[model samples]
Target: MTRQPFPRLKASAAALLLFGMGALAPGAQAKEAAPLRPQVAAPLSSFDAEVNTFLAAYWRMFPDAAVAAGRYAEAARLPAPTEALRKQQLAFAEQWLQRLAGLNKNTGLSAAQAGDLLLLDNHLQALRWSLTELRSDRWDPTEYNVADPFAQLLNKPDFAPLPQRLKLMDQRLRQVPAYYQAALAKLSEPSPLHLKLAIEQNSGALSLFRDDIPRAIKQAGLKPAEAAAITAHNAKALSALEEFIAGLQKIEKAQAGAGRSFRLGKALFEQKFAYEIQASVDAQTLYQRALAEKEALLQRMSAYADQLWPQCLAGEAVPADRSDKIARVIAKLSERHVAPERFVEDIKAQIPALEKWVVEHDLLTLDPSRPLVVRETPTYMRGVAGASISAPGLMDPKGVTYYNVDPLDKYTPEQAESFLREYNHWVLQVLNIHEAIPGHYVQLLYSNKSPSKVKALFGNGAMVEGWAVYAERMMMESGWGAVDGKPSAEMGLMYAKWNLRVVSNAILDYSVHVLGMSEAEAMNLLQREAFQSHTEATEKWHRAQVSSTQLSSYFAGFSEILALREALKAKQGSDFKLKAFHEEFLSHGSAPVRMVQKLMLGQ
Candidate 1:
């Protein structure tokens, strides 16, 4: 098996959004754009050279990753860069930004060519903001000698050999001091709340350090020298770390978990809202729209339930009871749909069918770069029900994409049965389309080799989420959806009903945490609006109280993607190809759905 090289470059979320808008490029405005069409695209970009250079420079910077990235046995022996070298790299970021800013993006080109430039511009813009403005020298507070990824980086068996990857950890660990100092040097006045949250966020990490370090050392099979070195460094870092922790704790105690919420002051709020929508849309206004939409969807879903689930009866349809039915059906279908069992098996079984399906379908342009393996979520992260597709992180030229289903076995057997029955084969199949094939993976795989180095690292969340949700609707229209090709119109309403629920998902986090809505209040809104199960509502309530900006990423992303698709259809006119358009939409790179929308439309 060949190794997938490490992703050397750092990308902000904006760069990623541009790449995600590859074909669309965000500016082509059209009406009634093709929906339910499979999005297979012609392969158009490569990041091999850029990725190789970035990885090489990055490995030079964080040698500990060599082991995790399959480049070395241990970073223990690697020479740690002196403070001089650290300064040199920071300078390099500045020079790179300058160099990037000088590129001539507007050399007469095709519509696609212009879109690529937009991605390029956005990428450089984010790099300038992060490297120069934000100046986040190290990833953040703690440095680990061992590569335990709690972020975008992950474990891919083929990325690098384990021993080689391990070799870089020591070097990375040694740089912790340097990174912390860099963060301090670059630290600007706190954004009032983010600073506080950043501090409070460390609390969990302190416990993690106290518990996770020794285990990591053992798991990594440390030599006495390596072990001793880690222990000594841990001790020294811990002293300073504890001081930092104490300071943070003091601030946090004063705020009482309030500062960490999502109350973006008008200035920050507008910036966030703009980046989120990927078009000219306001966050607060969009949220109000969501609230209204949520009400309508609840009514529609309830009505659909009464008709489809006749047992809901003529008298007194208890929403709690009815909601249980909705959850139960979704849950049951979901239960039977194991990542290892139903999903993977279906992918394999459909190889023959898909071959024919693609050829016969007449809308998609399947690329050979696609090599999929469906699997159950890894043992570590199974708690989140529902599945997700992770596009290749540091493996393969085209990162390996996984259609990960949350295994039902973790639930009680009875729960499992209900889960399976509720989720149903149709819902599971639709979810597959949403996560894999012509959805997230398809979009992300195209995004993997974006020309903009800036975007590869910092792709935004809205585009990622919007495309997947949009695909749900698109797939339903195409015959390649649901277990049964022809689901009843009620199920169609079910899909739309769920689509409207995202509005609540979008703002609930802000409402509860930032708006100071209590869980009881939040739960009531969610229950009344989303028709969510108590369990689901409660889960979201917890998620809302702690998380601030992320829940908004989804709906905002979807709207921007849809907007771009419409624009592209209008610009491309009668000649537009859904397959080609989708492929192109994600090819440019990821950026905020709005920032890249102009590019998506080739404006």
Candidate 2:
């Protein structure tokens, strides 16, 4: 999960609306009337002007995102999530769609501009679809967390002076009550899963008001009266937050077993897959591909298990069942994980080793100046995925990119042990590879450097996630974790099991949302088929319940990226260089793999 500065109101759609629009160079209007050749430049100029206007308006619609993206002018405001704002955003999207359509008919758009046009069109249509169709605001109470933006404002001390930033926080605080009130006004029969998540996350968000804000007030050394006024506003905000959570609890009680299902259902799930993933293939087809890959992975895992059986499980007869045979060997290897206390520490320690390995292998260039900070996941952002990378906004490319690891201190001993085994020594290394190193951290840095802001801002999840999954295999192929120029049977088996999780993610998401796979069946698939630990499987079930289409990102992305590499390699023949391929592919930012394929293959 890529952490953004603001909440994603409707899965990827909100990410597009908020995070995507945040990153393009702030002064795009400067290019609105750049001098152009007589005939060819006129249309492109008009197109540029349209884009500039759209972005300015887009920022107004999502001011918190704008603030995070370094548009400090929006720092003092919070747009109420009310019917008025929804209609305004919908009108904005529709107006831009028509304007873009008019511009696209012009003959002189450069290929890059054409691509940008496509991205903008898709983005607007997605926003419209989200408002009209997905309408998560009506069902997901988690959409309206005011604490996220407030926390970002206070945390970004370098952006402005303390008093000034504090002033902005005070301004935003004034509107918190209205924000939650509007949120409650819109929400009806909220999903039970999301209601619980909103409560848990907001409970943590209350810390910003109760603890962080007071500390900041003291540290800033504000005047007694000013501090008291801010304290009063904070009190009001706190009361509003408590009231909102209570309202959600009331709804939860009233709905009992009658709340909206978290499942997106088949039609909505497929449409969401199209809009969010923007992949070449449909969800069902990709799901079937994952099913086939699952069988292939099992066969490969069985082969490695057979090879290691004598060494790891000495003299014990191999079970006739393929899964049992593989699970036994994995269980033995899982014992080699780090101690519970050292979990986050171990992950931080591996970042450098992985970086060094990638540089030595010439897999990709390492930017020494760009830092990847490893830290505990913030309280409000803790419930989703266990590990995620929060990339710096494109406007602040040099800003810190955090690799957030959920701490294990809260887990029971048994739960921690199960999680540790699932992320054992070998699997842990692969996880680091996926979330950091040449995965998201590297990919996003390159994304920030992408010349096309459209591609950089509105990155395709499949492309971003695919590259990470591909990086794992790429590193392994480049002799990472190998012994005597070949991967050891143990490493090979563990890698297969880890990769199986990616495949199973696609399978699980499709089955649960589209095919109505129950928790029992989902657990069977995760523990029995995928060989996941009990804790890991249980957490995944919750994730699947809360999210749709995201689980499939790993497999969908990995498959497309691998296939694209082979296609490019096939076309280039011996002229292809590994590092060149990686750099060139990532140079396009995180555009959909199919789009990148067209650009790379020049078709």
Candidate 3:
């Protein structure tokens, strides 16, 4: 299945009592053994049973999601995304939300139980919000893309016996036409940007089925007839998808020059931001903080540029404008990147070195057995990102995690150069640190070990992205690329520029969706202030138009995690251990930083 995007807090007087023990501390074994405490255990057990029942029913509603999460039951088949299914999902969420509300939060609950309860509530709220407020089924054509389920099932080693998985793929493939029909009936007044993305993505889906499916079938060693039948089914599905695309194109042509609104506006943006970020603050607060942080980062970037200006200019006249000066220094640094053809392989080369660094430094513990593979981004999943990690679900921890990097072969030389310049050699290391190494790859392996599947399956995006961003900084601070005995100043400079990109992502997301920022203003913000290349700026503009709130997660989450670390250090004083802090911080699965804080700090 398409990997979900994966989110902070404080020390108080209760913090000492809570964080004094590690996050994985046994829930007072002495108390659990006491005869009288059975009363306490009974209610907690009841809560677990109730929540488990709810989840089973809920997963049945989205069987494809279940399969993606590593559940391989026969019931875990793709369901048609019909309006009836949507209504049923909405009613199911509402019904469970009420039933869960009947459970008392104040009494007879273990810490783990309380945390899981919080997760279930958040999950339900998010489901309700998506169905009722977001209404993606009505307007977002990308929601109907049928290629991902089949691709994920076939591509990943989730099922045993190739034929079993292929049969499941066949089942989903035959239902594609019905799914498309449902989508056609549901989608109306679609956003222009979303429509364009959906078209590109569906076209990529065609490529995926045509080019990738046969290879997968061959690898699976299916019988000749089985392979033929699977091929025919996929061909039919692709044809239906093409017809759906034609329908979408008609809609696009009819609405030409009459740009449908992409903005979520102020109210919806805040609500979605709250649900997605799951932080204490609202969207406006985060936006204002991002603005302030951007200015601070600019000053830091200027100092770093000043240090490198003499070297970069080689005695050429310095620019009078400070922003121009910083840009010049960064441009010089970006000159060291790999060529377009070598991009994917170069990224692959960095992973092992980074893993070595983490191991030598005793940065969080590494799992030698859990495999992480670097591969080209799958066709259908591209257009939105340069790279991403498709992590194994908690239920299927043994599954291979794919770190997908988009290739630069498709772009013209000028475009590819612009893209490469933005992701230079030093920045590439930092990017690897974020997407692989001790970033998404490492964080996710740990996530699979989380005691609570609720937190793992419904992880907070802010926390996930935040940890990756934070990991980039953590590695740099720990002297990741030291030359001889000295740390690499060039790496530090690249990191600062990358952090600026993170902050600007928040600004751009809020501006396009809520502030209604003009193209010129957004471009200037990304290019001039954030030091992004023209190509990167242009794509980010499209990303901002097609998505909302998600761009802000990196900054919002990184900020919260940083604050939590500082608080922990201050509370622990000399007792603080970086390894312990990391292990503890990540122990809560991918729950909101606030929930983690409560669990860790006894709040």
Candidate 4:
């Protein structure tokens, strides 16, 4: 999943909140131009007006976020991450906190509206905390990338006609130099890890100017002068990135072994978890739960290993050690994986099958009209995770949803073998269930359709990642791995191992950030305990350093969602329907699972 630092506040919602009850507030109407629809709904209107005003300012303040969230008209603007910008953002957040305080004084909010108020409060608070406390902007050069937004425009060409889109791309391209130059000036002693990531990503991103834009220019059939202008802009953009990379390299050389640590430490990790994950429990408590979960998953996997060993290794004797026996069986199964070349091809093929199964089981309604395009992970986005879903903006709901799978063509034979084995045959299907069909793609589609724009736009990470994780368990429990209605032990074993990844992620992140887990310790934890391949463990270690509190989302979200489902089930007894619960839970958009539970239970 992509980690956008700023919240993508809603445009229409802000316009409604700003002018829905009366004329636009001073200096707002000219910027928004949204029609005023005054509501006579008393206190609701009062609260709604406040939300709208906040949204408008938010949209203006973070146009980049707005564009990403589907305000395509704002695509030309690229806000630099400078000190002045951060200060302004800090003040904006503080001012909103006070405004929300005033809104909290009013009474009689519907549960959904009240949830919106909380979302706003948490969003502003998180923004404040990030700027004032976390302060990654000062130390993470990766935070200063221009590649992603550029890729978004070039990849989603249907957003406008060729000429119009090219015009916007040109407009944004001209500003790229200034963007990176400003970033270089502002970056303090940066993280060595993030600097490496920035260099790799920015270098790969040069393909846009070299290959993508030239093709686009030719196809658009621009005049010679217009083409020359774009070509010149591309050169400047390329030079800017090259210069930034050189600057980062110089810093890396000078600050070797002396750069700021990637670890968030205990205090920062807990606060970030509270703000980003928005889980009911603290980070420490969740880490403890994950430990218990790890032990339980091991017991289950060991049982499956015993059952499978006798069948697969009929003549061989089992190892006396429990860990050794399980490892042997998993290794045998891992050898059955596909060739490296078929990695992405295989993923695309399984998507339809996953959708078919979901529909066949009456699990949830699947939208056929919305397109899902499975593509190789773009070079600029490959370092973090192996697979992810990039959904269309709210403005472009009908646009394509990209399922990005990192191809293994670049991996050496050893790396490729280990990577493929990690995501072996059965687990790959489970992965498709998580990253694509009935996972990020489906959940995000539902999020776009949600009535609460606040929940939709300001999505909680735990809730989003959790729903995907929950979908995996939900799919399996609904007999997805059954053959003629009998559960396959192989599928069961693979799933248990896969679920270990979710458990291990929380443990790895918490241990690294808070407990100062060394690479050796983390590797031992993953390879020995979680049964992960060396390749997977290595990438995960890299991910942990670059990102904090994100890994914990899987377990935290899965646990909370399961609790919420059971509570609703017990409340309604026989009346509870799986599809109804799924739709109802998703209908609130992507609010924190806790707030969603309160809304679902009508608290």
Residue 594, candidate 1: how far off, in angstroms?
A: 5.6
In terms of lDDT, model 4 sits at: 0.78
RMSD of 4: 6.4
- What local lDDT does model 2 show for residue 193? 96
Q: What's the alpha carbon RMSD for model 3?
A: 7.0
Write candidate 3's Cα lDDT for 1-603 as tens digits: 012333111010000010001111112213212211112544645776886897688667666556556665522255666667767878887898788767634457666666666566656666666677667666677666766556656655645666777777777778877778777777778888888888998888897677676677788777899889988988888788899899999989998945458888997777677766766577788999999998898888888888887888888888889899989999998998998899989988888899899989988899989988889988877877778887766667678888888888878999999999998988888888998889988888887798777777667778888889999888988988778978766776788889999999999989998899999999999999999999999989887887777888888889999888888888889999998989988887887776676666654
- TM-scores for every candidate against the unseen true structure: 0.64, 0.94, 0.91, 0.92
Candidate 1 residue-wise lDDT, 127-220, digit = tens:
3333433322232222211223322222433544443334444444454454434344433332334444345444444543455554555666
Residue 250 of model 1 has an lDDT of: 56
Error of 1 at 211 (Å): 13
Each model's number of backbone clashes?
98, 0, 6, 3
Off by over 4 Å in 3: 1-44, 72-76, 156-158, 214-232
lDDT of 3 at 526: 92
| C-alpha lDDT of all candidate models, in order | 0.48, 0.80, 0.74, 0.78
Candidate 4 lDDT over residue span 482-557, tens digit each: 8789999989999999999899999999999999999999999999888899999999999998888779988998
Decide which is better by TM-score, 2 or 3. 2
The best candidate by TM-score is 2
Reference-based TM-score, model 2: 0.94
The TM-score ranking, best first, is 2, 4, 3, 1
Give per-residue CA lDDT, model 2, range 462-547, as digits (tens): 77878889999998898888888877788888899989999999999999999999999999999999999999999999989887
